[model samples]
Target chain A: LAKTTQPISMDSYEGQEVNITCSHNNIATNDYITWYQQFPSQGPRFIIQGYKTKVTNEVASLFIPADRKSSTLSLPRVSLSDTAVYYCLVGGLSSGSARQLTFGSGTQLTVLP
Target chain B: SAVISQKPSRDICQRGTSLTIQCQVDSQVTMMFWYRQQPGQSLTLIATANQGSEATYESGFVIDKFPISRPNLTFSTLTVSNMSPEDSSIYLCSVYGTGLNTEAFFGQGTRLTVV
Candidate 1:
């Protein structure tokens, strides 16, 4: 599993855009970048995933540079409800041969009022 | 996407006792995993439940302590035996999505408080 490094905490106000970056210098060729959001007392929810470049979904966007050493999760129009822990994981996606997902100390995003 | 339901959403258990957490998935999945999240800590993979065979546990976790059972493709159970106060944490069940480049889904998690 590729080790990831992220900020311990970030603060932002409502309607602002929040960007959290994760560095995975040992990322493998088959590894994919995935981000998850975890609210208190609930399971972590999948936000976005990408192998390279950019990928966007209904909730957020993932931007991976050409080097693939790091990736950023961009959340638009932040709200109080967006206050949660954001985790970035890098792992292979091959069925039956994929590596286990190892979570690092995630970024705690506090969306202030 | 897969929907997972975990039983005993929250429980307060006595030390030296055991508690079993059940995980049920809406659809059949090939990969089912168990994770432990200590308070104010990141999630740690406990084991991978393999159907029809013994589970594959992660380092620092053992079957005697966290035995896992995957009787079928869509259901599994984890037993925390001889619990201690140190075992207090949220236990989550996860399943890999069906296709390639997909995301894994997680259960609401079972919060266990050891007293």
Candidate 2:
């Protein structure tokens, strides 16, 4: 398991791009960086994942440098509904079983009007 | 992606009572996890439930306080016993993907309010 660090909170206006960065200086070779979004009364939803470089999805994009020490999640054209807490986690599967996931205090993004 | 249905979406329970949260996955999975989220805080791993075996609990969480049952691949339950005001939080269920770099899917969490 790798520990992750993120900003405590961020404020963004609607229609703006929001980038949340996570630092995992001790990330292992097998570790993958994953981001999840959680709304007020709902479960966390997987937003994006990346092993290296960039990966884009319908909801967000992930950027990872060659060192894999850190990664960023970019949400384009944000809306008020996108205001939520985002979590970044680094881990790898062990022996084809799902390993325990440790979550740190996430970055709380507040999308303003 | 997995579709998880968790029962008792929200409940207000009395102090000293217990509440059971049920998780049902649409498909079979190798691992099922339970997590607790305090208000305005992040999530904490409570336990990992594997079918046909004892659940592995995390540190600071005891089996006596939070017992888990995984009778099959698609179903599991977590019981919070001897509840108190401090026990009020959101409990979530999650399942891991089979691929090496796959993401995990989560269920709509259960909001337990011990009054």
- The DockQ leader among the candidates is 2
**Candidate 1, which segments miss by more than 4 Å at Cα?**
A96-99
Evaluated at residue A40, the lDDT of candidate 1 is 97
Superposed on all Cα atoms, model 1 deviates from the true structure by an RMSD in Å of 1.1
Chain B only, TM-score of each candidate? 0.98, 0.97
The two-chain DockQ for each candidate, comma-separated, is 0.68, 0.69
Residue lDDT tens for model 2, A8-93:
99999999999999999999888889999999989988888889999999999999999999999999999999999999999874
Please give the CA lDDT of all the candidate structures.
0.94, 0.92
Fill in the DockQ of model 1: 0.68
lDDT of 1 by residue, B8-113 (tens): 9999999999999999999988779999999999999999988899999998999999989899999999999999999999999998877786478899999999
Scored on chain A only, each candidate's TM-score is 0.96, 0.96
Q: In candidate 1, residue B55 scores what lDDT?
A: 91
Docking class of 1: medium
| Candidate 2 stretches greater than 4 Å from native | A93-95
Q: Pick the candidate with the highest lDDT.
A: 1
